[model samples]
Target: MSSDEVRARVRVVSPRTSAARTRVTSIASEIDDQTRLGEVYIVSLMRSQLRLAVGVLAVLAVTLGGLPLLFHLVPQIGRIELFGVPLPWLLLSVFAFAEIIVLGWLYVRQAEKNEDDFSDLLEGR
Candidate 1:
């Protein structure tokens, strides 16, 4: 072959370098870190909310369970009249109102606490 033809036919191939590999590794690590952090934050919030809900449920169960027992033990109290209605009716109405208030308060408080926790997590705290 002629010198010009030989030079023209010569081909150069670039080999994969360590720096490129390191760059890809670093990017993957950063993505993994972000994904793990996000998962941890979600788990923490869910745990906090679950704990709060359990506490609220415990309180509600105690109060609601005691109402029937109280009425049973104190029949006179349940039979007594209040504003032309039986005392039991009044008690039930009041209990229902109180339950609604307590549940609403618990829900609001839990939601706020969860929001705060999530905010803190996002803020890297």
Candidate 2:
């Protein structure tokens, strides 16, 4: 083939910096240096998670504590039949137990979401 008819191809690579990479490096450096901003970010994440826990605890206390009081205040409610079982038994075995399971599952999911959010914040995502 003639030089004029021949085609040549070459590959090249250039260094590049992304916002994500830059942010990661900067944040890592700040962490390594123990900067105030990094500490503040961590504290904020902890505060949010702690606040969530406290709120859930408050709700659980109210719900679990109130149930017995409600039953005590309404004695007839305890004797009522539900699905051929006593109301109190059904409440304890089914409703309360289900609530426990649901609350545990919900707490786990929400806590995981909070952790994921914290991770995203750390990664600047």
Candidate 3:
């Protein structure tokens, strides 16, 4: 093609024009302003944390509190000894602390996960 014909075939494309985009509100701003949506988010986070706490507490109560009842119902368990330490004493002292520690760790991890999810929502992720 001739230079003039080549020039006619080419057209200018505007860089500024594109598909329509929606404006997004910042969650941080909404929260800072204490908007209704922000309140809802906050309440949701609180509820999740509360639910986690209640669940952990319930588990601890059932397992630890049931120990005494179990020992009472089965007196033989107290007579059994492990390396000179009574079975019930070993369970209450050593195993109980381990259980508590595990439960505490689980509670903390779940609580942190809930907070992380809340933050992700806040960040619009």
Q: Report the error of model 3 at residue 121, Å.
A: 0.5
**Can you list the residue pairs that collide in candidate 3?**
none
RMSD (CA, angstroms), candidate 2: 7.1
Q: Of the candidates numbered 1 and 3, which has the greater lDDT value?
A: 3
TM-score of each: 0.54, 0.69, 0.69
Query: Cα lDDT of model 1 overall?
Result: 0.71
TM-score, model 3 to reference: 0.69
Candidate 2 local lDDT, 34-64, one digit each (tens): 8997787778778988988897788878887
**Once superposed on the true structure, which residue ranges of model 2 sit more than 4 Å away at CA?**
1-24, 28-34
Q: Per lDDT, what order, best first? A: 3, 2, 1
Estimate, for each residue in 1-125, the C-alpha lDDT of model 3 and write its tens digit: 69999887675443223221111345677667798977887889999999999999899889998888888899999889999999888888999999999999999999999999987876657
| Model 1 TM-score on a 0 to 1 scale | 0.54
Ranking by TM-score: 3, 2, 1
